[model samples]
Target: MGRDTSSAMVEHLDFFQSFDDVKVYYDNGQNIVKQALDRSVGKVLSKVVVRRRKTSMAGYRLEQVADYLSTIELALVKYEAKEDGETYNKFFGGIGSFKRNWLKQARCKRI
Candidate 1:
């Protein structure tokens, strides 16, 4: 089954609650994202702005950084589960190095 979009959106918004304002950019699923944003409640709704942009046309460096962070997070998950380590290894050398170099630093900047 597909993931629950509404719940996912709420969780993501919750993660950024400390921020005074948030601007979200996505390449697809604009309708789903907008509907989720509309349904959201609390102070976070006031802080968030969702914008749709084609990835190819997105010249923002933040967009690329977000994508890289997301990929690293997914790779970490897969690595821990023993499902996939190729990506983690290719980019980070090994699990020890991944945790020491990337994971620690990434956690500090997590949104």
Candidate 2:
């Protein structure tokens, strides 16, 4: 039998109360991260836009958002790469490849 029994065996994993489903967790995580980033960008822009009044700062603000998102994505990739190594291997060993798995791994690492 070639069936993967490992995943069929349930693993006890706790998550934030608001996220019942993994997809929901991922979506909420992305939204929360973006919102926080946007707030930070807004604060910086409020100060910078005063002096750069003539330039179109809308495009520049968007570029900053994109850059921050890319940075977060890179950190997640690092977590996924770590999953293949020694850290938290026991917790994530048989979970397989899901984009949100990195979130779980990162959380576990922090605790």
Candidate 3:
């Protein structure tokens, strides 16, 4: 991650601040992440704890949930862009249903 993405993460510092402690788990590239965070949010670094995990071998339940949510969000973006219509339509039952159903429910759980 570069300063740009790290800068984006800094924008969410308030979310991190809400929790007493924040733990970030990554599958790889710990060094890059650390560097990014160091440059972007170094002052609040003490509140965050970063860990490296081989998710493929031993993944946490939250990680699975995160993956699911991200996949759905990506699908929504692709649908809006009018890309991969067939697959999204088959799974989500068309754009109207996808928005009224999936996206609505997902947004309710947004943090």
Predicted structure with the largest lDDT when compared to the true one:
3
Least accurate stretch of 10 residues (summed lDDT) in model 2? Answer: 1-10
- Cα error, residue 86 of model 3, in Å, equals 1.3
Give per-residue CA lDDT, model 1, range 14-36, as digits (tens): 67766765555545457766555
lDDT (CA) per prediction: 0.65, 0.41, 0.71
Q: Estimate the TM-score of every prediction.
A: 0.44, 0.24, 0.47
List the candidates ranked by lDDT, beginning with the highest: 3, 1, 2
Instruction: Summarize candidate 2's per-residue lDDT along 28-49 as a digit string, tens digits.
Output: 2466564544444334333343
| Root-mean-square deviation per candidate | 7.2, 17.8, 6.4
Give the per-residue Cα lDDT of candidate 2 at 59: 41
List the pairs of residues colliding in candidate 3.
Answer: none
CA deviation > 4 Å runs, candidate 1: 1-58
A best-first ranking of the candidates according to their TM-score comes to 3, 1, 2
Model 2 off-target regions past 4 Å?
1-59, 83-111
lDDT of 3 by residue, 5-73 (tens): 556766887886787656554445577776665555544455245433344625477786787799789
